[model samples]
Target: MFIDSDIKEFVEALSSKEPVPGGGGAAALAGALGNALVSMVGNLTVGKEKYKDVEPEVIEILKKAKELQEKLLSLIDEDAQVFSKVAAAYKMPKNTEEEKAKKQEALNQALKDACKVPVEIMEYSLEAIKLQRRLAEIGSNLAISDVGVGALLLKAAVLSGKLNVYINLNSITDKEFVEETKERIEKISEDAEKLADEAYQIILQKLKIEK
Candidate 1:
């Protein structure tokens, strides 16, 4: 699995011409790394006397972050799998009218299928961004910088996923599906942007970084 591979291997494959590990997979990885940081901050905060009053909340955030981390990681493989379908569809024979029709239909379906994993990645990254905002509020003070980094990564994931979705949508023929997916992307992207910025600002103020 791509997830099981080392970073160097994954990056090398990503940099290669092979299409399985593309932007969608990379987006999922970014979100997973962001959630990992969120979980780290929560782990550092929980079971600490300094944060006892908020330890319970931090524990809950930790659970959610871990869940998101797993989901995003799984999407790394899933994005690759679905995108393979897209690649296969693209290679379908289109020499004749009948073949052309079949190829177009297959490509449409493959594009739709390929969109699913990136959309899920964006949705999960939004949730992760929300968690980072809360974690930044109550997580270990020493790890606040991690929260900032997490927020930035999650934001990148969301935007990256957005681009992947749009690219697929451009080729999809079903206007209804395209419109609905675009609407969902708009809402999720907006919320992720806002929450990520809020979390970053909180981290900056906590660090007492001057504007």
Candidate 2:
């Protein structure tokens, strides 16, 4: 699995011509990194005397962030698997009229399946961003900069996931599916962008950095 591979191995694979560890996998990784940062801040704050007042909330944030981090990491491999199905569908036989019809049907299904992982990546990244926003407000001051970096990573994940969705949507012929998926992506992207920026700005203000 891509997740089991070391960073050097994964980067080597990603740099190669092979398509599985492409944008979808990269986006999932970015989201996972962002949530890991959230958990880091929570961990540093959880047992500190100064932060004891908010320890309960920090513990809850740690739980959610860890869950999201694991889910996003798993999606890195799931994205590759679904995309392989799409690649295989493209290689389907299309010599005869019947063969062409069968190939098209298989391709359409594969395209839809390929979209599922990226959509989940976008949705999960948005949730992670929400956690970062809250963490920025109450997380450890010493680790506040990590919150800014985390929010930025989550935003990148959301945008990257949207692009991956659009690329597959371009080849999909189902009008209803294309329209609905586009709507969903648009909404997720809008809210994610706004919330991520808010989280970053809060961090900037707390650090006394000029906007």
Candidate 3:
């Protein structure tokens, strides 16, 4: 699996001309990395004597973070597969009227499916943002910075995922789908940025960093 591959191989694949491991996949992977950091902070908080009162809550957070991490990791491949289908649809022969119609139909559906991969990424990334907000409040003081970093990583995922969504949305002829998706993405991006920035500020305050 792509996720199982070493970092160097994965980076090479991402840098290659192949379209599968493109922006959508990269967004998912970034989100996964963010969630992993959240999980780390959660784990670090759960067994500490200083955090005993909140151990249960942190444990629950750890479980959720792990689940999100795995789901986002799987999404890396899912996004790639969806993009491959879209790419193949685009390459479909259009030599005749019937063939042209078929290609258009395939491309439309494939594009919509491609849009879905990034939509999932945006949704998952939002969840990561919200999760980070909680961790910033109760996570281990030593790893509070990780919670902030996680939030920023999720923000990157949300923004990059939106780029993938917008590109596909532009080619989609479904007016209702286009408008609804645009609205949702706009809200997600706004919420994500605000939450991430707030988390970072809170963490910096907690750590007494003047910067």
Tens digits of lDDT, candidate 3, 1-211: 6888889999999999887688888899999988888888988888799999989988888778888888899988898788778889999999999999999889889999988888889888888888899889988999998998899899999999999999999988778989999999999999989998889999999989997
Question: For candidate 3, which ten residues in a row score worst on lDDT?
Answer: 17-26
In model 3, what are the clashing residue pairs, if there are any? none
Stretches of candidate 2 off by over 4 Å are none
Candidate 3, superposed: residue stretches over 4 Å from native: none
Residues 1-211, model 2: lDDT tens digits: 9999999999999999988799999999999999899898889888999999999998999899988988999999999999889989999999999999988899999999989999999999999999999999989999999999999999999999999999999999999999999999999999999999999999889989999
Best model per lDDT: 2
Q: Pairing residues by index, what is the TM-score of model 3? A: 0.95
Residue 4 in model 3: shift from native, Å? 1.7
Question: Predictions ranked by lDDT, top down?
Answer: 2, 1, 3
Among these predictions, the greatest TM-score belongs to 2
Model 2 clash pairs are: none
Candidate 1 residue lDDT tens string, 54-162: 9888888988888888899999999989988888999999999999999999999999998898999999999999989998788899899999999999999999999
Candidate 1 global lDDT: 0.93
Ten-residue stretch with the least lDDT total in model 2? 37-46
Q: Which wins on lDDT, candidate 2 or candidate 3?
A: 2
Model 1 spans > 4 angstroms off: none
